[model samples]
Target: MKQTIPGLIAAIMALSSCSQRTTTTNHVKVKENPVNTKVTEQALDKGLFATLKIKNEFKTGEPVKLKFTVYNSTDSVKEFCKWHTPFEPLMSKYLEIKEANGEEAAYQGPMAKRMMPPPASSYQKINPGDSLSVDVDLLKGYAVQKPGRYTLSYTGQGMSGLVVKDSVVFHILP
Candidate 1:
């Protein structure tokens, strides 16, 4: 019986330690203030990720489509996160719009590298293993525009403690 007592105590100690094991999710923690508050809300949702792609181009007044893929890894889809204008000045500083002939174009409202609030018609959703695409023109509805490379960057936060960022590079040509 004494032998059994030690064995039982050993089993109890092992089981108690197992309870202390913690499950930590693999995600990047955002220590700094978010560029947008919506990022904080989205970071709580699972399976939320954004994919960005940029194409090199050399034409002005042409379409410069920006595509984003929002996907959910879990079965439930949440709309806690929304697209907001980026506050980072660097986000605007990196975009360079030159003429097709290699001349600098006139400065417009916000630079291309900055993030813009989604238009009124903008609503993005993602389901489990599903992704969506967004397209925007380089200089929507413009003419006599310059041709040059354009860079874009977007930041997003997921509810699952995931922060995603994407950068794109495009150019305008004659």
Candidate 2:
């Protein structure tokens, strides 16, 4: 009976801690001011990550296809909202694209106004050591008119607790 009591207590503790999204840590605690949490993008879980990839180059007015993948390297399953991601139709401009001169490419896609805590249908699940990918054409959303090198990244909060590594570069020909 004594051993059973300790095992039960441990089980309860594990279950209780599984559903929490925020934790208290000196530099990583949830901020009292919501505005300060904007920088929390840098504080996302390292276990879940996103990456952007593109082809070598593109011609002016050609399709600049982008391949975005979300990887779950942890032992547990991870989930993220697919609303602002490429898994859905291009309804919102969630990508940040910059020209070679550092000017942001204008977003020419439709803008969608959403409510907080998105609908349950907007979520996607990825299992451990698995990845989900979606390919989208940048030309359909952002105005990639300039013929030069450009950097593309997933800056949207689609996958709630993951950081997107901005390392994709592509060039456009005149």
Candidate 3:
């Protein structure tokens, strides 16, 4: 019976983990357009990681919407500056989108001047195992109206205090 207890506990733990699924929970950053969306990212390291969620496809002229989510996977709370992320009003473009052929989309947004040591208002705190998300219309800052497969990633040239280690790829159907 010694082995039976441990085996039963492990079985239950496995089943519980398998039951959890991606969702738009109360922690949802925004719900401007509540279409079905799911976790589109996988972590590249421990501590904190970022993910971009987008539809697998879109129609030309339609809003190429994106959801930027930052998850804290560690046991402690973490905070970071929100600059260059969708968490704040986007004055400067922060994403680099490229076509399948490696052509980069042009930026046509206004760039804002930030004061040294971004004010406390510019930071966000995420609790352990919790996530924060924000919605941004990709087209608002980038000229990406063409219908084609495009890959989007954080430029890493000063995009928030956290690094977006993962990216997402989607297609535009004309």
Candidate 4:
């Protein structure tokens, strides 16, 4: 019988490819947690010298640390400049991140006019009580997945207009 109609059409194409591979593996293990549960905590001390600390609480896939401090406390040398070159330096450009129904965590790579380079300059000198520290890992430049509350602001501009702002309030648990 024609090999029983090609073995019943190969058993209905192997049961429709095993039910579409178990519905695409159950839709990729169903993951949904775009942060939302009504929570608020605001803290800001708008730059005057420099200080931005982050890490209130985190444990949902970890990795979000930012600690920047730049204070010369005046009385002599205090020169810091960098025309362009930021994918780090605490990710400046007046960094600001907000999430908790306010969105804005989409700075996810390849756009900074395409990794800037052409017009450049650089300098750094903080003396007389000195202070210049930087540590950043905010998921390698934002796009902070799921979890919860987050607000981080930074204003670090040096040279002639010397300014350094700070703000932090973070929490991400699951």
| Candidate 1 residue 43 C-alpha distance from true site, Å | 7.5
In order, candidate lDDTs are 0.41, 0.68, 0.69, 0.51
Error of 2 at 165 (Å): 1.8
- Over 108-155, each residue of candidate 2 has an lDDT whose tens digit, in order, gives 999887654566676677666567888898988888877988888777
What order do you get sorting by lDDT, best first? 3, 2, 4, 1
lDDT of 4 by residue, 1-174 (tens): 988999898766543321100011112222222222221221112111456677798888788877666554433454444322232353234466789788778776443332222223344555544566777777776777678898876543422233433367898888
Q: Give the per-residue lDDT of model 1 (tens digit) for 1-174.
A: 989999998766543321111223333333332223243344334445555555666455556665544544444443323323121221222233444355544434453431233332333444434455555443532232554455555523311122455455666677
The C-alpha local distance difference test score for the whole of candidate 3 amounts to 0.69
- Model 2: how large is the Cα RMSD against the reference? 13.7
Q: What is the lDDT of residue 83 in candidate 3?
A: 70
Q: Model 4, which residues run further than 4 Å from truth?
A: 1-52, 58-67, 73-75, 82-110, 113-141, 148-171
How large is the C-alpha RMSD of every model relative to the true structure?
Answer: 17.5, 13.7, 14.4, 23.1
Q: What is the lDDT of residue 112 in candidate 2?
A: 84
Q: What is the TM-score of each candidate against the true structure?
A: 0.43, 0.70, 0.70, 0.26
Quote the positional error of residue 117 for candidate 1 in Å: 16
**Which residue pairs clash in candidate 3?**
none
**Model 2 segments more than 4 A misplaced:** 1-46
